[model samples]
Target: MERSEPARHRGQTAVAVVLRVLAAAALSVDAVVHARLAPGYQAAAPGGLGEGNLFVAEAVAAALVGLYVLIRGSRPAWVLALLVAGGGLAVLLLYRYIDLPAFGPFPAMYEPVWFFDKTLTAFAQAAVVILAAAALILHRRTRRA
Candidate 1:
C-alpha cells in the first residue's frame, strides 16, 4: 500500500526535525569541548593563530552553525554543518596520527594521544557529519519528491 503525500511529508518533516536537533546537539558538544580546552592549548602554543585561538574559532563556528541548523534546517545549513564537522574531524585525525610541523601562522598541534576531551570531541564531530549528511540527503530527496 502507498502512503498519502501529506502523510509522507509529515514523516519526512519529523525525520528532518530529529536530524536537525541531533546535529545541533552534536555541534554544541563540539563547541563546548573546544572552548573548554582553548585556554590550555593557547598557553601551550602562544603565538599568532595559536592553538588556543584556533580552538576558540572552532568553538564559535560550531556554535553558530549549530544555531543555524537548529533554526533554519535548510539545505545550505546542513551543508555548512557537514563541512564544519568534516573539516574538524579530518584535522583531528590528521593531527592525531601524523606529527606535521607548524605551517605559516598555525602551530604544530600534533598530539599522538587519545585523551577524554579529544575523544569526546571526535565523537561529536563524527555525529554531526553523519547527521548533517543524512539531513542533506533527505532534503535532496524531498526536493525531488
Candidate 2:
C-alpha cells in the first residue's frame, strides 16, 4: 500500500519532531552532567584549564548545539551536534582509561571516576549522537524526495 503524499510528509514530520525532542533531552542531560562534574575535574586536573572552565565549556557547547538543532534543524546543526556529542564521548572514554598526557598548553586529565552522573552523561551523549544521526538521515531523505 502506498501512502498519500500528504500522509507521508506528515509521518516524516512526526518522526523528525520526536527525534529532535529526544536529541534535545539527551543533550540537556549531558550538559547537566558536565555542570555537575566541573567541580570534580578540579581534583583531577587541578590548577589547569580543568575544573570549572573546561566543564562549563563542554556544557555550554552541548546546550548551544541542542538549542541550535531545535531552532534550525539544518544539516550543519546536525553536523555540529554530532561533533559535539561524538567528540565528547571520545574524550570521556580516553580520559577514563588512559591517563591523559599533557599536550601543548593543556594539562593531564586522568579522571577514572565513573559515578552515576558520569554514567548518565555518557549514556545521554551516546543517545544524542544516535538521535542526531537519525534526524540527519531523515532530513536528507526528505530533502531528496
Against the true structure, whose lDDT is highest? 1
Q: Least lDDT summed over 10 consecutive residues: which range in candidate 1?
A: 41-50
**Tens-digit per-residue lDDT, 21-136, candidate 2:** 88888888888889877886667656667656677888999999999888777789889989999998998888889996888766676778897887888899899899888988
Which ranges of candidate 1 are over 4 A from the true structure?
Answer: none
Please provide, for model 1 over 23-66, each residue's C-alpha lDDT reduced to its tens digit, 9 standing for 90 to 100: 99999999999999999889976656789999999999999999
Error of 2 at 6 (Å): 0.7
Worst 10 residues of 2 by lDDT: 44-53
Model 2: residue 109 alpha-carbon error in angstroms = 1.3
- Candidate 1 TM-score to native: 0.98
Clashing pairs in 1: none
Measured over all alpha carbons after superposition, the RMSD of each candidate to the real structure, in angstroms, is: 0.7, 1.6
Candidate 2 residue-pair clash tally: 0
